[model samples]
Target: MGENKNIILALVLSGIILFGYQYFIAGPRIEAQRQYEALQAEQAAIEGTENAGVIEQDDAPSLPLAVSVDPQTDQSSSGNYTYADAKTIAINNAELSGSISLGGARFDNLFLANHNVELNGEEKVQLLVPANEDNGYFVRFGWTAVDASISADDLPKATTIWTSSDTELTPQSPVLLRWTNAAGIEFLIKIELDEQFMFTVTQTVNNTSGNPIQVRPYGFIDRKQEPVTDGLFVLHEGPIGVFDDNLEEQTYEDLRDADGGKFESTTSVGGWMGITDKYWMTVLIPDQAKQLAVSNLSYKASGGYRASYLEKAASVPAGGSFETQTQLYAGAKIVETIDNYQDEFGIKLFDRSIDWGWLYFLTKPFFAGIHFLFGLTGNFGVAILLFTVVVKLVLFPLANKSYVSMSHMKDAQPKMKALQERYKDDRQKLQQEMMAFYKKEKINPLAGCLPILIQMPIFFALYKVLYVTIEMRHQPFFGWIQDLSVADPVTPLNLFGLIPFDPPAVIAIGIWPILMGVTMWLQQKLNPQTNMDPTQQKIMAFLPIIFTFIMARFSAGLVIYWTWNNLLSITQQWYIMRKESARRAAKAANKA
Candidate 1:
């Protein structure tokens, strides 16, 4: 009875964890997403009405470019703007394709060449879009005048149309954009692209106006609106940065309500700041040797947010030129690519761009192990299976001790029943006797809970890996399992689509979840269950069903891992039980 209570407590705790996540986190997110979509549609309709006519280049609102000593107070232009069909320098490479808008010299239109919006679709994933589009996001670099003599208009503004040196920008060929102001200050942005997603933007200012000038180079990633996030508390999606080698993450809501709608970091020497989505990110990496201040800001008037950085002002002597380089990383958050960029460019904690959660210690290495297996198998699903086997082997010793203790408890059930019957009238006596019985049998009543407790962190770490990593996006397993990063699509509710009717998400139970429930039930049966209260027994019997429903909304890859882990556990426990029973029978025979 005591052992049964311990098992029941463990099961209840597990249920609470899953239920709390769904109710407190996932449920609200789903509703918020629905509301956000409706709001977006309404905004689109209003924009469509206001922007009915063909908008000229001159009519487009210029993005405000101002540098403040306190980045929190930096302001930007407001009002609606259209994507002007202006001149652009074509950008083509093996990993990315887009056009660099010569106007404002912004990286406004970019797409990941290897990733698609849909599993079977030809349309590529757009990482950055034109400033006028819905959820418009882009990166731009400019010089901020620090001297009172240099006015903002005398520097390059977003309206400035720079002349491009090259017709096309590629990995092999870099482009140089040149612009001059009335003050005889010529601003040049030499853009270079790597084979992957890193773009090197070197800003050079040649001051021909004789008088000494002071200016600070700055870069910013602008998002026209708050994006719809995954809504999972486990995954962060919004403004993130690594300042002073420490990672900081803030949500859109937090940034909006911050003091003056801004969050600033202490002056740090070389860090990266960016806005990140679930799979993609746009980070501004300044020169590693420069002292800079990073900030996350939200503009209520423009209904947009920005992550920006301002470097220490550089003094350009009367005839001397000032040059500073900042790198922009815009693409899918592949772990290897990000790590490589971190190592190659000496970007501080660049891999932190992918929200690895608080369990970075475990989550990253777990991903690395599965990633290694993926390299050999060419299939992420197979890699997950192999990784599970490795995890099981590594934890076998501890689990074996737990299972052996459980087997002993099961073997002593008959004696335990007699003890329970004798003390049924006295609750205190029953408790005292049970403890004595457990001691005599060398059994730990709470031994069964150890395995369940141990699995919780591992489950969370794997879930984080599947939920946040781009490598798992659109990855296929076997038949009908095309995308492992989402819930199983083939549901039995509509006879597996044989009836041509799609069931709602509430009843959308898949085959894998059912298999997991079955394995969980079988594993539970192998545990000691005799002399337990009838209500507790019933509760134990229903846990598998409860978990099946809870996990139905989780990613299929996670469901697969859970199911595979359960099956392995069941096999190990059953073997241990059989061995324990055989040993008990042989000892009795020898005693006879």
Candidate 2:
């Protein structure tokens, strides 16, 4: 009874923590995010009327080419501009479709050809938007001068127009953009694309001038507005990078609160920096052998943020040329694709982009197992079910031992109750007698908690896999489950959508959660509950109900896993309990 009370207390505390976090912390944060987004929208409307497509350039970093201090006179700030306003080289590949802006040679327009904005929508998922758009997000590369003789005006700026060598960029053919300054230095950028998301950029400086010039190459991803994230604590959606083989993640708020709204890294031999959304990312990978510096910067004045990298200075002598190569990854974060990129390009910790939570050791392998099953089954939902069975099989021995212990405890329940009645007025005597009784009967009072404890990490890891992996996005289960990555859409609150009225998310309990609750309750019935007081028993009975409501908002795939696992546990425990009962009855018959 003492051990049972302790376990019950722990369970209650866990529930309180989960519920309190959801209700007091997550709920308020979501509401605040909504209000912040509304305020941003209102501000955007006012700014749109006043400035239109014009983006106010801040005091550009010293390592990058400086922008015009006065926005009114900045050439890049000139009137409303669109994709049609610039000369662009069309980019067409099997997995992507967009154009590279020739002006400033920017990767400003890109879309994932294989991914759609919605499950049933024809519109492709836009990854990068032109700088002229309201939420301008783009990647651009250029050279910054290290010598005093090479003025900022002489270097290529965002408004500088480049001549493209090719009309279109494809996997088979690369494009070269060329521009020349008045100093007679020719600047060139050769851009190559693979079938997937990677873009290889080679920037060259042909110093035709009689003087030797020193310059450093740099790349930047500028986002004009802070993106609205999912706001979940488990996932990250902001500036992320790997510098010196160390992973770094910073939120938009963190960047905004930093000193001067900036975070700079020491020189690293090889690294990649980028801004990551929940499912998409745009990363700049510098040469692995070269020394470089990375920075995450936030501009409060213009409401913009940037992730940038600057390579070490290279001296371009007269009649000689200097060149540097970098790579850009801009697309969806498919797990396999990211891993392949890391292996092929030697990108450090690229798989960390997926935000596989603290249980990465478990989460990663769990994903791999489920993904392999998905490959064979052709459906993520079926794969999850099979994976749950695999987990059960692997844990069968330990679970069997746990169930046997629980059965023995249940068989000794009558003796335990007699002891309780014998020592009703003596608490210390009851404790001593109960301990002796447990040892004599070979019963482990805490054995019932072992299975639940082991399942916790697995549950969290699977949840991470479902929430963060892009492969799960838009993947369907059986009928009515079009996307397993989201919560079950049908709810009994509105008669499974038969009624026109839609219930609030809080009360919208789905079918899978209810089924899970049923299975959990059944599983609990098979466990040893005789030692618990009436109040403890009542609290335990309500656990399934509390969990059902809590998991109602979880992804459908996770709920399915829980339900199937509970069913498996119930079957195993039932078999053990029945076997134990038969053995006890057979012994009694022999004694009679």
lDDT on C-alpha atoms for all candidate structures: 0.80, 0.82
Residue-level error in angstroms, candidate 2, position 255? 1.4
lDDT of 1 by residue, 252-280 (tens): 88887887676676467888888898998
- Candidate 2, residues 272-375, lDDT tens digits: the string is 88899999999988887777743444444467888877776688889899888999999999999999999998888889988997999999999999999999
Report how far off residue 61 is in candidate 1 (Å).
18
Inter-residue clash pairs, candidate 1: none
TM agreement with the true structure for every prediction: 0.90, 0.91
Error at 243, model 2, angstroms: 1.7
Report the number of clashing residue pairs per model.
Answer: 0, 0
Give me candidate 1's TM-score against the actual structure.
Answer: 0.90
Q: Cα RMSD for candidate 1?
A: 3.9
Runs of candidate 1 with Cα error greater than 4 angstroms are 1-85, 297-301, 414-440
